[model samples]
Target: MRPRSCFVRSSLLLCSTLVFSGTVARAEAPAGPQAPPAPQAEPAVEPPSAPQVEPAPSAPAIAEPAQPAPVPAAPPATPPLGPTRPKIDVYVTAYGELQFAYFNYGLDQNRAGGAQRDSRIEFDTNRFVIEVKGGLPDYGLEAEVEVEFEHGGTGSAMELEYEEFGEFDQELDKGGEILVEEMFLSKKLGANAALAVGRFYVAVGTLSEFSRPTDYLGTNRDEAETSIIPNTWDEMGVRLRYKFPWGLRLTGQLVNGLDSTGFSSQLWSAGGHQRRFEVQRATDMALVVRADVTHFDGFTFGVSAYHGDTTRNRPKADLVKSCEEANPREVAPCGYVSAPLTLLDAHLSVRKGPWSAKALVMYGHLKNAELVSQRNARLSNLLGVIRTPVSDNALAVWGELGYDIASVVGLSDSHHLFPFVRYDYADTQFKPREELYDNPRFRRSVYTVGLSYNLMNVAFAKLDFGHRRLGSSAFRPENTLRFATGFNY
Candidate 1:
């Protein structure tokens, strides 16, 4: 073989090996010719003539429409409506009273009149008023009941008017009495009207419920006022009251009065056999109506009228006659004297900020009345007479003014520096002169001034000065200075 032919064969063989064995990879694989053939003869030869086209006219533009606002989500419902506080609650309160009273007399005697060292250092339950009030969920019925501890006592202090002024250490089941202060069931008749029934406080007078430890004035239920309309008196009855949005409340009640007591065997028996045997004559029937108007944040004015018939019979003195009268199946021939007792009361109270003023007037008339000389068995045994005639009418007026100066003057935050004055005037029938025929006597004028400091609602200190003038010209005027400190819980 020739050398050139051998060389060519070898090179060909190497190339075959490289390709077939897949040892050396090709860097750029050859594809079909992408580069246009250098200017094809026809393309280079001539450029095609451009086709003719027309220019379009300018077009009008349109604006896009605005989108509507999205609806907002509502607020989450308020927590299930409920009273701020639960309906059930229990409270306990007590008070201790230390009082020093000074009475001065003997201005005319000239011998000596210094001070009576009668000081009272005692503790009073004041009130163990248990209150149960709540609204039932399913029935929506509202009920309230209050049991009160009324004070009772004996001795010279107890002989005075309004025995409630002393310490009450007696157990309610014993000497102390448990009184039905209030008990009523109420139902809502409308949005602002309510109907109620039960024994409840009479709807009359301004000061009936205004007595508080914070009050500086001394004297409760003035004779003329309370004796007539009987403040804080209660009777079994029905009532309706409405509250206005403008802060006015009107209430009306229909109840059994004094006569009801005589009819109730429960009350008669409750007092025991002695009382039942003692009280011979009793009341018959009575009716009462009252109206009150109150202005929001301003004043309250009220008027009340009551009429009733009271029995005027003295108990039979002779034991044999009484036993025969009370004989079984035999109705007692108890003598009954009919007498009409009518009362009218009016009151007005104004509260402007810390200053308050109140006035009240009560008038009572007893037509053709007789005073039983033998009012009780003891009295009859002591006096021998059994019946007496008493006829009279009475009028009583009282006024009070008070101001709270805590804001104007710097005092303890919990304290109220109050200066107060009260006045009372009344007419009486009892006369001191035994020889002269009993005439209408006027016993009037009660002046009081006091200041009270409070250490929160649980404690208070009071200093008061009072002057009272009686009808008797010979009797010296009475003056009283009182200082009291009280603690309560």
Candidate 2:
């Protein structure tokens, strides 16, 4: 054999042996796990003079394997039993009023000597009030507190006592008052009902429900309600309220009744509010029921009724009926006489667009009013009561309407300018019994006109003129001009 041929044959034989050995080694290796295949090397091309061999194709590139995705960790365990703390929120608000007034008649009807002679001008701090409200949302609990300071909250007052036939008494302890208008805690009974306990406003009239100065159109509160009852009346009591889905609300309350010792002819039950002492008497209880309907937008109407015994709440148990035979040891030979008081009222309010209006009518009756008058007439001079006879019935009606002139004059919505008129009639001696005299001084009618300006519902100013007429034209008519300013938040 030629030397070149022998060399070529030997090279081909060596390559074949190498390939067979690699295959056998791979096949005999352990078969437990497999790794990614590695790229194989290309075979080397022979020299052109030795052999005509085509170049082996290059091996394709191998890619690295993708990394595995991460596994999520497990969450921490929670306790089976735990108390949840409720979220509590608190809010505070305040309002105040200052007043300047000019009147053309005497303030005291008894001392006027049957003629309106005294004219007066006065400046006063009408009221300053602060309120705090708090709520626990999760527990459905709410709390509110309101404090009021009137007429600077400090002074000495002079009172005229008719029990001693026009006597003067100095009330050094009671002039201006620091009043707790409301303080109550409420708990939700369900989605539509709630219960409240503590001192709260009696739901009897418009003033008790809407007490802010800006709530009404006139410079002052309604004269009829203020004259016949304690305006913004409040007593320690429990109240239950429920609201229906169709815009009806119902309320019921049980509260301490009025003191008969304070009842009088001029103001009827106005002075009956138990403010003469630090602690109030609660021997007599009152029941109040109220219902309101708001089915129409911007309108609400309601009726309320109050019934309670008055004789038992007097300062002393002295109004009992005479016994046939009296015992010295027994305080009341016969059981005390019944002198219950009853009141009923209907009220309506509207605030639609640029117009606002309010109307109310009230009637009240006192049982055995002649006997009450006789007892009051003989009271101690220091008690400060009018000795005149009290009638069995009282009636009051008032209405006010206003229109926003700002809307008509192309003013911004944030500014409100309302021109309003109000009418009031209150007859403390609406009807008299045969033994009682119907005093014309107790019947009064008032007409008022005013302009009110408000800035964004936070600040307000008002100017008003009022004329008052007595039941009989023989008495001179009275007139007043008032200016008031206030803020609410």
TM-score of 1: 0.58
Off by over 4 Å in 1: 1-100, 105-130, 137-140, 150-176, 215-231, 244-248, 259-283, 312-336, 371-391, 430-442, 455-458, 485-489
TM-score of each: 0.58, 0.80
Worst 10 residues of 1 by lDDT: 264-273
Q: Which stretches of candidate 2 lie over 4 Å from their true place?
A: 1-85, 111-115, 155-174, 324-330
Which candidate should be chosen as best, given lDDT against the real structure? 2
In model 2, the clashing pairs are none
Name the candidate that leads on TM-score: 2
Q: What tens digits encode model 1's per-residue C-alpha lDDT throughout 1-489?
A: 444454444444444444543444752222233413322322322333311112112111112224455779999988877756545433444444556666665434222332223433333333344556767544446877866554442111111112544222221234544555678988887688888888677665654445444433443334345433444566667888887877667777765544211211111111211122212233244566666676556777878776665442223322112433454554344444445567678888776777767788876665443332122223322222222223245567888788878877877667766688888776534332243244322354678888766676677777778877655544355677777766655
